[model samples]
Target: MKNKLLKITTNLWFDTQAEEAARFYTSIFENSKIGRTTYYGKAGREIHGMSEETVMTIEFELEGQTFVALNGGPHFKFTEAISFIIHCESQEDVDYYWEKLSQGGDEKAQACGWLKDQFGVSWQIIPENITDMINDTDPDRSARVMTALYQMKKIDINTLKLAYNE
Candidate 1:
């Protein structure tokens, strides 16, 4: 079978951190790599005000998904309204991702398995079966799991399991 190209790709804006952010993200995820990198030149100099040869965009891949990090300047900032979700299959997976992504991140933004990374990007490191647990047919079980989840910053699979069982 031929490899299909992704129709929709995520574009991340950064103020001079496109290369840095892409490198950091690729290092944390398996099967990830840095691809093509574009640089600024005399074109659009009046509007961009960027030095010639400065990084313009960096293309990278993480777990088969393509992403482009652009050095779009400080015209915008990242917000919690848009966030990425990292679905984990095991407690170890959850812990690893949480720790790696949360390093040097905003402590106050962490809650219910959500964190704002140092790059100001929001991420939710949650269990792969979180939807199943929270959408259980039994309302009481689902409520219990939600309560346990709300009390956590980094999701604890064991605690969620206990709540689901109770």
Candidate 2:
């Protein structure tokens, strides 16, 4: 099979833990790697006020998706408004990622399979079936699934299936 060219890459902003965050993410997901590591230079110091020799960015790829993690200082922070969605193949897959991604993060922010990682970056560990179930032709069935989903922190595929049937 031929590899397709990647057209879009997501950029992540971090205060000072860009490398750490990249390492942590690559550890959790398969087919991921921490790529080129760059440092701030004298030119960067004048622009971003970061000390020369500090980590400027980390180029990484996670589950085939490319990304750049920036140590761009504390002027910016992640919000729930934007989140990376992990489309899981099974209940076990969801469980595995949810646990890993949520560690050292705000437990209080976990709901509807959405969680904030240690770096405050939001992620949604979703089961593949959830989207199909929630979009069922029967509105009541879908609504029930949505209600069940809202009540739980980590999404349970079995529970979601049960709700869809109900």
Every candidate's lDDT: 0.96, 0.93
Residue pairs in collision within model 2: none
Candidate 1 lDDT over residue span 1-166, tens digit each: 4798648999999999999999999999998999999999999999998999999999999999999999999999999999999999999999999999999999999999999999999999999999999999999999999999989999999999999998
lDDT score for candidate 1 against the true structure:
0.96
Tens digit of per-residue lDDT, candidate 2, span 1-166 = 4798748989999999999999999999889988999999888466799988999999999988999999999999999999999999998999999999999999999999999999999999999778888888999999999999999999998888889887
The segments of candidate 2 whose C-alpha lies over 4 angstroms from its true place after superposition are 1-6
Clashing pairs in 1: none
How does model 2 score by TM-score?
A: 0.93
Per-model TM against the reference = 0.96, 0.93
For candidate 2, the lDDT comes to 0.93
